[model samples]
Target: MSALAMNETLTIARLGQRGDGVAETVQGQVFVPFALPGESVRAVRDGDRAQVVEILTPSASRIAAICPLFTRCGGCAAQHMGEGLYAEWKRQQVVTALSRAGLETEVLPVVDAHGVGRRRVTFHARREDDGMRVGFMVAGTHDLIEVQACPVLAPGLERAPIVAQHLANRLRASNKPLDIQLTASEAGLDVDIRGHGPAGDALRRQLTEAAERLDLARLAMHGEIIVERRAPFQLMGKAAVTPAPGGFLQATSEGEAMLSRLVLDAIPKAKRVADLFAGCGPFSVRLAEKAQVSAFESDKAAIQALSRAANHTQGLKPVAAEARDLFRRPLLEHELNVFDAVVLDPPRAGAEAQVKRLAASKVPLVAYVSCDVGSFARDAALLVAGGYALERVTPVDQFRYSAHIELVGVFRKTAGRK
Candidate 1:
């Protein structure tokens, strides 16, 4: 066997699932980051992974990255590709996953839901000898890369890094690594700091003063509220939801609205709808506008927020919420039969247990929202085998210039099949 060379020029044949370029080599397939297909690049090979040393010939799809920290920060992966190629690669992710599951269906063009970019941004902070360092971690390393500006953030969150640094400086006395989650809401920035222990009276006072100076709407530490200048509320259709501290939210407002529209349109006439894995009633509250919604989630805070929003809103049908772990005790066939349609937005793992029961139910329509295409394909195949036909699949690009893709699949029960 020929010895594998440490440095070699190779042609990228394709893009991998994580947005890395795959180059076939004598040793094996080398995964090169920031190299697009049809491009020739020189890389230092280490087994299957390679670090691109230089681009010998760039692909036609290659484009300059908007962010200066594109290669340094782990937040984005596909920013170097042209807009058309970027969208096609993301769409292909869904198509490849469904193909692997032996399912073929019509997939609509990818939706550009990254309107003004992400509304929520998380920055890592640590006390430095000079002062404090706040930024995203380096790609594939724990080292922090201090950022002065970020291009992918919404206009409302343009000062997120600065705001995080300000908080880090105020809490520098703790000398602990912290994760500052800044979410842009209608009121103002909702700040949540994690990894810090319970604050003392002095620290609490400092935080209060910082919040006032920063003009923050609310501040929380370790999921506990410290101060509230105003309620950090998000409008979902006609309902107002104050999500829990550090709770899950759609990356962008446009993405949430797009996903909700796709979901609602799938089950248009659903008299009774069951929203599984409902987080803060993003889909449940909207669905309730035309259907009675029964939302089930594991987070107590999320369920409370959903119920409160549902109760306070007017002209909507009944909306009930239960804090239940659907993974452990999914709504069974008989329980699922009560609802005419079901909508589920499961995490990356894709709600296997709940999907199994849903496949056995007599529900006429289903809207499956997923972030992980592989898991979505697995569950989708299950539904297909259970006599449901995939009506349409729409890929949502909430995380632009990155490998991550979100999708909503609409399925309807077909006749003459159990």
Candidate 2:
């Protein structure tokens, strides 16, 4: 390889975050996008980027990407890899992160999904002179890209931004102030709107009339805008929109079901459980059927959803929901002993201080769900150093084709401890 070369091929050796193909050519680390971990391929080592040119040796894991927007859409990155391989890679990603962090113990099996289920997606939109431009964030930046279709819309609002923009234009023609939300639910289109500038009777009529044209079932309006009576719409059989802005929850019902199952199974044998960072009762409601669950989340709005979920379940024990900033103020060390098992579903940052306290609190078993492998590994090492034995690690494909991977690992307290 010369100091300055236009095009050169490099064999990929491993994987990294952002779903890149990692390789080394004595030039530090070269990451190849769109290439799997174990592929001996001709990748053009561009200045800051690498592209797969030819595959000399392909890992059994490589598969044809199904989505048409595999290269264009920024929603997911690993779609081109085989479904089974994708799952395996995800598991390995966590294991690698953990192993490097000094938790070089047994990493368990992983589960595969034919298609990653994405329930909800937020699209960016703005009114242009010609038409309304709408789509997802650009690959590396927040610059929005206009798109016709997305694989991740919950259901009813599959073409939400497009449809909403059209309605907004009609309202504009009729001179109405318009803010809109089109929620996806099996129950159908439930919309909400808030407006202040223009919506007169004519604009309001136009907005509702446009929604009627789209065959929407329920619609509510405020000022010059039409909005869903409730946000997020109810999923499955629920009767309300229970999503908070930017607060993490499963985007797809299928994903939620899969993720919820993992949390429930993590501590199946336990009686009393504490579900940390339990947002909107995803796992808490599911686990409630089998065990007494105490749920905790930082957001009060999320806690409200958990409270409602607890009230609705029949045989399930309503989870005790508490709202607190676990980062700033973690669960007290003494309080960790109140449960037989502790289940944590933290965000990408993973559980550190909480895991440290759990290890010190003498909890018998802990199941942690994490989005970041590196963080999971670090936290797992802390637990292991504190004498927690690794039991099982399961990775689920929630967001398919992307660099992001979700994992659930169960750790048991080491035996014969002093």
Candidate 3:
């Protein structure tokens, strides 16, 4: 490549979906990280990807990053942008998705749900001769960046890196890279270590001692309990739920509550509700307060947890949980008719098969919660074509500083739809 081609000064025109600033060049388009729109920057280009060397003219929306390791840690993007631009970028993600789907509806402003940062964090730990390196991976690379502290973590989990390091040091004898998942719960820090093989009696004893010293509520290796100081429970609405080891939880408690509220508001009068793809009853437990809930999920452990929570909790309407894969056998139209409304929170792939059945069903109201905008748009288009009115969508800023945005889209079946 020519020197001029490799080293070029470019003006950022817009931000891409992954939060990279896009610059139109004669060679097509270049994507530069840590650069904002309307800013002129000098970058070293390799094909269409560029590394920002210097910001010649910074945009008005540019701001100093709060975290020193913002660009290097790969945990957050767009942190350099001001709050106004950041919020608009997140909201426009949903707007762009809806526009692509050929559907236009009022989208509420993005809700700031990233309160006090993420409650749960996963650290990548690799054993070394000196000790263990524990933290997140560098952007687009497998290089581990040892984080001393993270601003994005919940206050309760401020010492998570230290906790993870302690566990890693104790388990370093196994000589295995580990993924340590830490969740700050009511009891204490719930620790789940993955990528480690079955622990022998000696290793188990060491882990137990480490857990005790670190004051962990629970410690599990490969989803099997090594030590349990207390039940690491999370309160979902009125009920207390002990989620499965290393199971999915919303990044922040505030995000979970906001999503639940939006989902609840979408189906205000729903007496009988089906919580599809329900994981550990975050929504089901809340919905059960006002409606009879049938929660279906593929994870047996999660369903069991939900079932146990519902059975023990008092004053909640009947909540029945079943372990069934909705992708393979979605609730058919006839089976779906029994519910007054339905709330489905599918994974990133976005529940195509299940949505097809929902479109054919007589369920009057459907609230779709999605993490991926592209998949949501595709599924929303399907529902819109199937005699459903695309109601207002509210985008939730759960994963802040990143391109990912969660949305709750309400769809109501048109009149006279059988």
Candidate 4:
């Protein structure tokens, strides 16, 4: 391509789903990062992607970014969008996805569940020629951007980057890449290190010392405990749950609370509830407070943690926690008859198999929680085809400033049980 063709000033028509600005080029649509709609930007063009060289005309909805590493860090997107534009953009993501699936319904406004910022973060560490470099990867690139602090993290994780760096320094001799996941818990910071094959006794002892020095509650390597200064826990409703090392957790405390509230509100009078793909019983333990909950998940450790939390907490109804991979063996339609309501918080792939069974079952209500809109829309279409009405969908923003969006959709059986 010629220099003029490669470097052109383009007008951004709109924002794409991934938070990139869409500019119609002669070839097709070129996605430009950090550019907003109604703006003219000079960019260095690749095939279908472009890097913004200058914002020739800034959008009125553009605002100053909060983080110094905004574009370079790649951890956040849409940080420059004004509050109004950002909210609408996120909500429209759900609306657009559902519309494409031919399942149009009331999509409530986007809920800002980013209160106090994220409680969990994973820092990537690489041992370079100079030393160990620790931080997040740049967007679409493997290059690490060294981060000292991240404003998006909860105050409890204020020292996360420093702690990660210290841990990296300790393992620099191994010369292996590391992924350090840190979660701020009720007791203190809970950390798990990955990619450090097997820890020798000497290394374990050193990690124990490092954990103590860092004031960490617990430290583990690949889910195996190396040190336990204290049992780290998280408060879910009235119960305090000590999750499995480095297990899945909602990004923010407020996000979990918001999602739980939405789920609870949908099935107020249900006496029996089934929590599917339930990770560490975020919804199961809470749901047990009122109804008998049968929690199912593929992670045995998470189920054990959930059961222990339920057994220890008083005033909650019986919670039968079982370890089962729903993707392979979905609870059949007849088996689903025991529960009056079902709540699913599946991963990004969504619960296609489980949802299909629910679609044919006699279950009255379903509170479907999803992180990916496309997957959720596909599953919702299946449920609707099975004679369920998607009452409404509420989008929750937990990973603030990022393209990620969480949502809770309530489906009610409109036709008699098949």
Candidate 5:
């Protein structure tokens, strides 16, 4: 065996972004896969590098992953850490980010909103001579690891790949690959077929036939390929969800609904609500039924979705949609007065500039939902410096069995009444 092939015992000092055990051997820095922090491992730096010869000491937070594909699939990184500890790591991550920014706010314990109505999911597919193959990318590479089921998908979406593969072949359109996205709602699945629309209903019929054979929930097609059944979805705001394929949405249905409710709980009943960075208006539309919901997003497509959802309802507060480069051009101080309560849901980058504006603004209340702890914490600090008391930071387990943590927090001026 080559010297590199020999297994050597080493201790992992820290965790890497991809959840690998990051440690340095006397020889050099070595990254061992599947080794947990605090564990001592004997590993061979194989091309696929990882081996846990022995765990000298285990982390209190270390826990086994439930999914068989947990280690091999790149979709999840922190699954090996148990839920309780996972929540804490995420919480601490958030706290640390805020502290670095000089913001102080009380972060509440994480909330678990598992097994509920998550709205949108995107699936990948590959064209092959035999047929189309679909599944998530293999853990770290572009290579596809085809599978019949994905535990992370909503129960209905487990067959998404199977359905998409069949349609691509039946349509005789293997040249253009397909990305199938499913969005769920009370009405059912809204299927968005992205990439290559077939010319007419004749093609739609062939696509429909393919969908029927696969036992799909609903079916739609993009340019050339057909979409399978799932849910009837409109992007919610002015967004098409298609143009921005990776737009942020609640990864799970339960978490999405819960986040909306939390915002409602935090804000006092008001005539207006400002949803900053609102993608597709899931919160804005729901809130619009009661209070006028103003949804702001950088993407025009998202604004359109919000507008349509707003128009569909009655006895509902009006929905106003606006497109702005928020990161570049955030709402000014004078504009903040239009809203009594602000519901800001930024991406993992979080709302740093918005938080600064919020802190200095006289707005009485704020509801913040974040996916990344670091950004959330930084913004939380800003909110704190602005005289807002961190009412609570509740972690929402939208991505179960994964290290990612979502937080919904309500903040208000310390001097202002709750």
Candidate 6:
């Protein structure tokens, strides 16, 4: 083999943003998958990336991965790191992102929100000559890695793999690629199958039978319900919500609770609050427990779900939900000033346009919940420039072992400051 493709010993110096270990090579920095900082490894180098051939010296922080499918399945990245290293790595992701944006604020240690593991997962299914394979894709590849079980899944989803395979088998005749999404809800497993295109009435009947046999709570194809044995309900605070099929949700139940707690605690004195980019009222329903909340979201289905949940729940402060694309038409300064505080849990893009409005508004408190730290940092800088003191940021690790980090930040308006 040429030097470029031969096995070479390298010392991992640090973990990169994607949880890959970085080593300073003679050529440049080489990234090795499944390697850890302070570990020396023999790997086959191909340009800037390498596959570890052997671990010559292991890092002290390295631990046995809980999942047997750890390195094979692309579901997790930091399974090898010990608890201390894992927590620090996740927390530093927030701190570094904020620092790059020139916003200096206290970032607390990561909160462990991996309670009962992930409640939702998507398994890709493809048919082979022998049979159909269902599991996660290999890291950086389209190839599927068959999984019998996943340690990172909640107990309610222990049968997700089996259920996915069963569904795939039912649709095997389509000969098209399939993506099956299963979510653990109070009613049972809510399943949504995609990638096989529109389903005919015949296929829907077949799927309905399959769902019945498997005892599924509900089944949908491409977000269209095939069978509804029961409503897939999720509890947000005291409200029972039936989120739109395949809608966005926090990875874990615990993650949502932690993020909600942080948001609620930040604006305790506020009477009226605005929830921008609110999805199915996770925070809105909870915030309504103590304050009147106005929620704005782009998805009409989500808005309807939130409204229905709010209306059905008792003893909650008035919750008014409106379907408005905040990106195109953010609430203006005058409209925003009506609320004492704003709690926004935007998508990964963050709420740049809406934050700009909040920055100029008289809203005294802003609780920002974010999934992407880079975008969050950029918006945080904008808020600080507008005279909002970023009190603190807390990183919550719901996607454990993965590089993704969620955070909640509290920003208070400074009196007489621009």
Model 4 C-alpha RMSD vs. true structure (Å) is 1.3
My TM-score estimates for the predictions, one after another, are 0.97, 0.80, 0.98, 0.98, 0.79, 0.97
**TM accuracy, model 2:** 0.80
Q: Candidate 5 versus the native: TM-score?
A: 0.79
Off by over 4 Å in 4: 1-5
Candidate closer to the true structure by TM-score (higher is better), 1 or 5: 1
List model 3 lDDT by residue over 116-179, tens digit each.
8889999999987778888899998999999999888888898799999998988887788999
Kindly report which residue stretches of model 2 are placed more than 4 angstroms away from their true locations once superposed: 1-5, 36-44, 52-63, 113-116, 127-130, 141-144, 152-157, 167-183, 189-226, 230-241, 244-247
Candidate 1 ranges beyond 4 A from true positions? 1-5
Candidate 2 minimal-lDDT segment of 10 residues: 223-232
Candidate 5 C-alpha lDDT tens digits along 257-295: 788888888875867889999887888877776788778
TM-score of 1: 0.97
Candidate 5 regions off by >4 Å? 1-6, 13-18, 22-31, 45-64, 116-120, 171-173, 185-188, 195-205, 212-248, 352-360, 381-391, 414-418
* Whole-structure CA lDDT of model 1: 0.92
Instruction: Note the Cα lDDT for every prediction shown.
Output: 0.92, 0.68, 0.92, 0.94, 0.69, 0.92
Model 6 residue pairs with clashes? none
* Candidate that would win on lDDT: 4
Candidate 3 residue-wise lDDT at 285: 95
What is the Å distance of residue 242 in model 3 from its true position?
A: 0.5
Candidate 4 lDDT over 41-142, as tens digits, reads 999998888999999999999999999989998899988999999999999999999999999889999999999999999999999996999999997799
lDDT at position 102, candidate 1: 96
Candidate 2 residue-wise lDDT, 30-108, digit = tens: 8788777667887667665677778888888877776676766677787678766666677778777776776666666
Record all residue pairs in model 4 with backbone atoms less than 3 Å apart, i.e. clashing: none
Candidate 6: clashing residue pairs, number: 0
